[model samples]
Target: MSLHSLDVRQTALTLLRSGVRNAEVARKLNVPAGTIGYWKHMDRAKRGECPGRGSHDCPRCDGVPLDHAAYAYLLGLYLGDGHISHYSGHRTLTLMITLDDHWPGIQDEAEAALRSVFPTRGTCRVRVKGAHNIKVYSKHLPCLFPQHGPGRKHERLIALAPWQQEIVDEHPWSFVRGLIHSDGCRITNWTVRKGKRYEYPRYWFTNVSDDIRALFTDTLDRLGVAWTNCTRYGKPYNVSIARKESVALMDAHVGPKY
Candidate 1:
């Protein structure tokens, strides 16, 4: 009855290859749905049909290049709201990014970013959860996003690897755009002085992880973007760029979200 047994794996693969759905296979074998997916993924890897970056000897192996803008954007997404998980007994990696459904065109931008990083892979699968969130999933996630580790992102030492750092250094604006698009927002703030109404636009990014906060702030500094730090009481740490010129600069690079 063990799901890890070779018999179970072979049966699951056969069922999957024969057009059986993952949920059905899991239900019939009394195994977890994830287990079925893991087996199917492994089988595809063996057949050299795994998506994203392909096999080492693949003719299309020109997989996602290192130090590319798309990779930087994906890294930002990962640091912001993405998650990575490894399938048991397989080399499969699942990368997921969940975004608020209310953000208009953010979902399309996210899909574009993922596709740019995994050109060989088809469109990522999207699932609606709860009432306000959209989740996207792809199997080749780990190849581009290697920041996966134990515990919450803030609790760990979240420094970038050398190669990633190099890419970010060369393409700071894209990195910043990705980070802001995920964890930050551009909006107008209203105030009243002596009964006179005034409105100003700004950019804000917040995160609970100190290391990630530092990374974000440092990148901003390198880009010569001025910002200030504050706290959200019981919530996350905050970094805001409210200067008129700074907001204009960010708009030039990050633009306004559709």
Candidate 2:
């Protein structure tokens, strides 16, 4: 006979399905960790689902339809400020995107995009040192983000697959918005010309990776947005969009991060 009630078991299963760690669920429900583990094992057996392997509805692996716009945005965010790490002793991989805590809207958008990309999976937000990390776990993240490889992104060459290229081509604005949200920003610059003050808004994308900068500029070219390379402290480390028409287009689509 099971020591725990059916209600308790069901609650435990629900939390487990949402990717909550066993220890967390146990603490929340006031149950023993070993007991929770055993319950999870038995529940998987009952449902004929493989443990550790979990359930995957990956668009790449399972042949399901993908939200291309959401994915394009997520790809930008990933390329800008996201990373994937493998869970030790498990087949699961966790994807985390860090955003400034002050921009709650951007954080929310990031979370929504991640959920849209992985509707069947669960997501969590954690705060660390003035930033919020939106994280999700899946076994097939590698299948989706083939760009994931060893070493810092700036240290390696990054290229897009054919299918990813198609998505970015279709949803360039979303991609730009994601990149801007991650590593780019808009600011107003002022100057005095003929004793008259003039102010203009400009977009700046700074990344150490030449490949990533190329990707951003290439997308801008496709969108008819003009950009220039800017030097900071004697280093060419920024892409500046200051053309009036280009800034207008960016304002129409991306605007200032909020």
Best by lDDT: 2
Candidate 2 deviant stretches above 4 angstroms: 1-56, 89-91
Which tens-of-lDDT digit does each residue in 23-142 have in candidate 1? 999999989997787677656644435443435422223433543787677678779988766655534556677777776577777777766666555555455763122333455443
List per-prediction Cα lDDT, in the order shown: 0.73, 0.88
- The sequence of per-residue lDDT tens digits that candidate 2 reaches over residues 104-136 is 999999999999999989999999999999999
Using TM-score, give the best candidate's number. Answer: 2
Candidate 1: give the clashing pairs: none
